[model samples]
Target chain A: MEFSLIDRIRERTAQARDDVRLGIGDDAALLAVPAGQELAVAIDTLVEGVHFPRGTAAADIGWKALAVNLSDLAAMGATPAWALLALTLPNADADFIDGLATGFAQLAQPYRLALVGGDTTRGALTISVAVHGFVPAGKALTRTGAQVGDLVMVTGTLGDAAAGLRLVQQGGQDDPRSAWLIERLNRPVPRIAAGLALRDCASACIDVSDGLLADLGHICAAGAVGAQIDASLLPRSSALLDWFDDDASLDFALSGGDDYELCFTVSPQKLAATQAELARLGCGATRIGRIVAGEGVCVRDRDGRQRATARPGWDHFAA
Target chain B: MEFSLIDRIRERTAQARDDVRLGIGDDAALLAVPAGQELAVAIDTLVEGVHFPRGTAAADIGWKALAVNLSDLAAMGATPAWALLALTLPNADADFIDGLATGFAQLAQPYRLALVGGDTTRGALTISVAVHGFVPAGKALTRTGAQVGDLVMVTGTLGDAAAGLRLVQQGGQDDPRSAWLIERLNRPVPRIAAGLALRDCASACIDVSDGLLADLGHICAAGAVGAQIDASLLPRSSALLDWFDDDASLDFALSGGDDYELCFTVSPQKLAATQAELARLGCGATRIGRIVAGEGVCVRDRDGRQRATARPGWDHFAA
Candidate 1:
């Protein structure tokens, strides 16, 4: 029965990738990484209630599972190559598996990422994805290279997913604009191309999985620098602005997580090229702030006054 | 709090490996796969109640979680390199985490397997491990090469784990030999050295996680051949024999899972060398069966008569 389910998944996710010497069936997958390229690997796990709402669609869960891991690769400026999924389901629900494979394939097809191997078990619903990508030696972006005075930039709008979550929790399912926000929450686009373009220009990079303020704080800690973001400069989707007050939307943009957008630091000299390159990729870059000489992350109002927040962002254990 | 836990884990498992350009604390780990080597990747998930009993020790869980993934690499004749762990717990318990990390480090230190990068989440306890290893190009043993008349072999004694599990389930924890059986269940050693030695000689190889009969059946199905095991020749540990009668012990040997031992097929010409090589590795190899002209797996009793069993092995969904 397990074999049959594996066969079903294999049939659905079949693709022609020569680099995958062996796919799903074997005890372990055989992959050939191009010579001189380093392999970038990341893993993330999503539980039914903790990561997503209890009743979230399996298709959305599948997409988000791979997207989160791919976002990690994107933050590293690596080109995704293969993924291994370890799926735990409450039962063998064929429809759920079909929906999940469809969603996973939809995102994977764009990057040509192969589902090389995985395991399925009977348990509480949990999805774990480990992605492998290739980055040219000495070229991967990291969160420890930000220097004082570097511009902190982000790709795409923030607060949409957080607003979407708010609408979801408030039972705003019938709102016409809710679809747009919910889509942001359910299907996030990993900034892979923008990351690749910023590989040489960006001094430091990270994905906004823990909200902008919290994630940027990581950069500050890693590079032993500080950052100050202008609240008014934060990018928010039209839907986010329309659904909430200015202050509420700004708060979400500041500390609401699950955006999956790339937040990077670029030196002033490379700012123009970085902006133009990301613009060409269709996810225009937004300059939010600058790396400073102090410690931790600070947010300033449009008038340049420091603003206080109750807390920076979500911490799974703390919450 | 999450960061502190991660720091604790990183400090405990720290090792200096030059190939690991970037380890934990990065968005993604950067690893260099030596030129002319293929990467072998495998993932496995262990959930509470499903993979292990409810009261199992955290240390045992951690050791088994990694051991299972390493066994997958061993089946492919790959030397362990690095591992990514995604640990989901009911809550953040420092003592539990410490115990688990200790168990994991105990197994990993021998192979020099570095704990690279991973995620920790809040949910029902689950440990998903993805292991990365390197095998020389074209040397990976797979399940597709078994030819007619190949000698079927397995490493280490079988059914001890199964017997151990039975004892645990039957409330025999206080028995004189229960500790020995329970140890087998908790810390089944992966035969990495034996698998490495069999790389050149074995036609097909797989790890026995789903009982000898079920796992061997996979080899037959993949190679499109048949197999017949001589029941009398099946290797049983003294503990398993002392715990159960001949019939029960033989049944456990054939269909009890979680052995984490390698099962391989070698041509008659390589049989002697394979046995000698594995014996030198200290685990030794046992010849229990051979590839036949037909399909499926059959077991012959001492009188050379075919014996029928109720089922092959454990299937998550089917069970």
Candidate 2:
């Protein structure tokens, strides 16, 4: 039965890749990273209730599980290559497995990523995925390269997923805008192309999983710099702006997490080129702030007055 | 608090290696798999109640989690290099994290394996580890190389861990031999040296995570061959033999799981050399069977008559 489920997954995710010498069904997988590239590896786990709503669809869970890890790779400017999934299920529900495989394949096929190997066990429902990707040696972006005077930019809009989560928690699934917001919450688009474009231009890069204020704070802390953003400058989707008032929408963008967009820093001289490159890729970059020589992230209004926040971002343990 | 916990783990598991360009602190880890080597990757997840008893020590859980993954690498004759650990806990238990880190570092330090990156979240206790290793291209031991007329051998002893599990489950924790048995169950040694020794000569190799019969059956199926084993010749540790009667001990050796020993096949000409190499490594090897021309595994009694069994090994979904 376990073999059948594994076979089902393998058949669904079958992609012919020459680098994957030995994939699923083996005790371990053999992979060949092209000769001059460094391997970037990341792993993330999503518990049923903590990561998604209790009754979330199995397909969404599968897609998001792989999406989160791919986001990590995206943050590092790595091209996705392969993934390993460790699925803990409450029982041997074949339908759940089939739905999950379908969801995983949907995301993986676009990146040409192969599902190499993994383990399935009986337990509370949980999904863990580890992704391996490749980046040219010395070219991977990191959080420690943000320099003073660099322009702080982000790809795509923020706060949509967090708002989506709020609507879901408030039982607003029937709302007309819920589908769009929930889609943002459930199936985040990892900015792989933006990251690849930023490889040569961005000084520092990070994905916005933990909200704008918090994730940008990570870049500041890592690079020994500070950042200031105009509260009026945060990019918001039309749905977000239409759903909430000014302060509430800005707050969601500031402190609410799970955006999965790329928050990066580029030198002033490279900003135009970076924006043009991203525009060509169809996800235009939005400049929101600039790096300064301070210790933490700060936000200001149009009047140049500082704004205060209770917390900059979400911490799982703190919650 | 999350950063502090991560800091504690990083400080404890730090090992300076040139290939580890970035470790632990970034969105993803950057590793350089040496040129001309293939990367071997494997992942495993162990849940609280399903993998161990409710009150098992955090340290033991940590050791076993890494041991299982390392055993997979050993099966492929790959040298361990780096690891990523995703730890899920019910809460922010500092003491548990500390103990777990200590246990993980204890096993990892000997191999110089660095804990490169991972994620932590709130959930039922689960430890998912993805390990990456390096093997010379074309040198990995796999299950498809076994041929007819090859000798079937196993390293260390089989059934000790299963016997240990039985004792623990039966409330015999305080038995005179309980400590020995429980140790086997909690911390089975991965035969890295034995695998390295057999790399050039072993026709096929696999780690016995399932029972001897079940795991060997996988080899037979993969290699398109059959296997015949003399049940009486199966190896049993003195501790296992002294605790159970002949039939029970033999049963455990045949179908009991959780023994992380290597079961491999070698051509008849390589038998003496393989045994000598393993003996030099201090684990030694025992010849219990031979690869044959049929399709499934068969067990024989002293009179060379085949014996039938209902099932071969444990399956997580089936259980």
lDDT at A144, model 1: 90
The lDDT of model 2 is 0.88
> Roughly what TM-score does model 2 have, to 2 decimal places?
0.98
Could you report the Cα RMSD, in angstroms, for every candidate shown? 1.3, 1.3
Q: How do the residues B1-319 of candidate 2 rate in per-residue lDDT, one tens digit apiece?
A: 5565456666777779999999888889999989889999999889887777777788888889999999999999999999988888889888998888888888888999898887888888888999989999999998888999999999988888889888888888778867887898888788888877889999999999989989999999999999999988898989998899887888889998889999999999999888888888898789999999988899998778888767688876764
lDDT of 2 by residue, A113-176 (tens): 9988888888888888999999999999999999999999998998998899889999997788
Show model 1 residue runs off by greater than 4 Å.
A1-9
Residue-by-residue lDDT tens digits, candidate 1, A154-265 = 9999988889988988988678879999999889889899889989899999999989988999999999999989999999989999899999999999999899999999
The best candidate in terms of DockQ: 1
**The TM-score obtained for chain B of candidate 2 when compared with the true chain B:** 0.97
Q: What pairs collide in candidate 1?
A: none
lDDT of each: 0.89, 0.88
Q: Which stretches of candidate 2 lie over 4 Å from their true place?
A: B1-5
Please provide the root mean square deviation of candidate 1 (C-alpha atoms, Å). 1.3
